[model samples]
Target: MHVPEQIPDHLDFVGRGWHPLLTRLHEQLVAVSPSYSVQQVKEKYGTLRIHLYTGMLRHLNLGNTDWPDPDQAARYKDEDDAARALVHAAEQESARTCEACGNPGVPRDRAWIKTLCDDCAGHR
Candidate 1:
């Protein structure tokens, strides 16, 4: 796998295609943790994840990306649950929100599964 040259604290590890959604997510995280880092980003079951899970994967939204605190999600413990919850919440938001226009969108399953706004849907 190719690694990124650097991982910015407040920026996303994904691409510009998801800027609208990611920017909003970044803003939300800044309100809580300014130093948060995004570990990954891609359309769920899209080109990114398809290299691993296919045939078995029928549905997907935005790609799965994790917030900071890697070990927090390993197992949701009493104390770690809160942290994991925050990360999960953000991820779900990305799945539901539009990656282009930052509007409410649903997962589109055409050739690839992607979360998009009505206007931006299939426009790519």
Candidate 2:
């Protein structure tokens, strides 16, 4: 797969067609908060899967730091919500996009389920 330089190498496991989608999502996350980091990206049940992390979540995990005050916390929550919405949109788009060639597609069932265009499905 031709992984984009902006994306981490570990996420290259996902299909090439979704690279643009991933890249756009990454850019959106960065705009929301540069601290956002993608932990995983993959294909599951013929759809794209993405996992992400942020410093705010890490702070919460530490359970010791009152890192952000109430006002800041509310702002962070809004940003997080926006990020989640973006991810959902990307995943929904993936369902209709060919995993092999980025064309319009639908989920297909064989030995394994995959989202593919008619042409790409024929070759498989």
Q: Among these predicted structures, which one has the highest TM-score? A: 2
Lowest-sum lDDT 10-residue window in model 1? 50-59
Clashes of 1: 1
Worst ten in a row by lDDT for model 2: 1-10
Each prediction's TM-score against the native?
0.48, 0.84
lDDT of 2 by residue, 17-112 (tens): 778777788888778766665667789989988776554673464464677988877877887788788888999999999988889999999999
* Over 4 Å off, model 1: 1-12, 15-42, 46-79
TM for candidate 2 is 0.84
Candidate 1 pairs with clashing backbones = 42-63
lDDT of each: 0.46, 0.77
Best by lDDT: 2
